[model samples]
Target: MDAKTCLEKLKLIGVLSFATVDTQGNPQIRNISAIHYEPDGMYFFTARGKNFCRELLENEKVQIACFEACPAKVIVRQPPISTRT
Candidate 1:
């Protein structure tokens, strides 16, 4: 699927797993529900003092996975990108 289509699917899916790395280089995964899609890029929200928020601040590298069990199935791999929110 195209980038726009993939982003649309992400919105439709709503909640998805977001993975990040900590200072120790250990992988951490969390569920993120607040996601916004724009023409330029995708954005998500987290509280200021949250661990996940700190993780993002220290390491911008992250991954998102969307799983849909329906008529159609898709898995998109998004590269690591910096985010500020």
Candidate 2:
């Protein structure tokens, strides 16, 4: 599938499984619904005090997956983009 199609599917799915490694190098997974999609990439939100946020800030690497009825699983592996105002 193309990038556009994959993004559309993700948006439609809403919640996604975000996998990240903790400070101990242990795997962690959680369902996240706060997401925004762009043509180039996607964005997700997590509370600053949450383990998810800490993991992302510490590791920067993450894998996002979404499973639908047709089993269209999309695994995105990339470092989080930092934007400064």
Candidate 3:
């Protein structure tokens, strides 16, 4: 599928699973519904004080997963750029 199509499908799914590693190197996962998609990539929101935000700040790498129940398909992606400064 094309990028546009994939993005559309993700939007239809509404919520996506985001996985990240904490400072202790443990895996953390959360469901994120607030996202903004652009041609280049997508942006998701989490409170600055939240562990999810802290994990993202500490570790740039993240895995996003989307599941389509009807088709039984799973899409996983990792951002090419760092999310932290």
Candidate 4:
């Protein structure tokens, strides 16, 4: 899907799946709700001490996906980015 449509789908979905890796390198996916969709960048919240946090610290690469009832999907593959709000 296109960028605008993807963003709209994300907002409609509200919650999304964030995938990370355990120490052994297995895939771990979790449901997340604290997210903000910005024109310049997207924002999401998770505790710093959580496993998902550590996974990002250990491996910068992360995968994010959000799907809607219309069968629309948005997949993002990139390194982790941290910014103070």
Candidate 5:
């Protein structure tokens, strides 16, 4: 699906899964609702310090899996901005 369609589908559910690989190549999957989608890409909030945050900083390769009638996976890269400001 296109980014717009994919984003709309993801937003409809209001929740998504974020997966990352640690330095040792261990797969890390976690349920997340903090992801926001845009026409260009996705946006979200995270602290400057956190395992997930650190992981992303080290490796931008990540996945956004949203709960749907069927499973959907969206590969995400780059660090998400902190909305705390």
Candidate 6:
């Protein structure tokens, strides 16, 4: 599907489940129910500075996976903001 189609699907499904690799190369998967998807990318709300934010800071690269238990769209991008920074 194209970006627009993907976005529409995302909107219909607000929650997203994905994983992020920390500096240690450890895979951390999180189920994010609150996500704000923009044209550039997606955003998540957290405290001013949290470990998850630090995780994003440590590794700008991330994978956001969403699907209908079938075809999955794995999005790879650097979140604009990290919980720590």
Top candidate by TM-score: 2
In the range 1-79, model 4's lDDT, one tens digit per residue, is 5656566667887788989899998999999999898754567877887888788788878887876778655887767
Leading candidate by lDDT? 2
Candidate 2, residues 7-72: lDDT per residue as tens digits? 878877868998999888899999998888898778766778888888888788888888877756
| TM value for model 3 | 0.75
Question: lDDT tens string, model 1, 1-85?
Answer: 7878777777778688988888899999999887888975687789988988888888776777778766655555655466666
lDDT of 2 at 65: 85
Clashing pairs in model 1, backbone N/Cα/C closer than 3 A: none
Given candidate 2, what's the lDDT at residue 20? 92
lDDT ranking from best candidate downward: 2, 1, 4, 3, 5, 6
TM-score of 5: 0.73
Segments in model 3 whose C-alpha atoms lie over 4 Å from true places = 1-5, 72-74, 80-85
Give the alpha carbon lDDT tens digit for every residue of 28-68 in model 5. Answer: 98677777677766677767777777787887777776667
Two-way TM-score contest, 4 vs 6, winner:
4
- lDDT-superior candidate, 2 or 5: 2
Q: Would you give me the overall lDDT of model 4?
A: 0.77
Give the Cα-based TM-score of candidate 1 against the true structure. Answer: 0.76
Task: State residue 2's C-alpha deviation in candidate 2, in Å.
Answer: 4.6
How do all models score by TM-score? 0.76, 0.82, 0.75, 0.79, 0.73, 0.68
Worst 10 residues of 4 by lDDT: 76-85
Indicate whether candidate 3 or candidate 6 has the larger lDDT. 3
Clashing residue pairs found in predicted model 4: none
For candidate 6, the clash count comes to 2
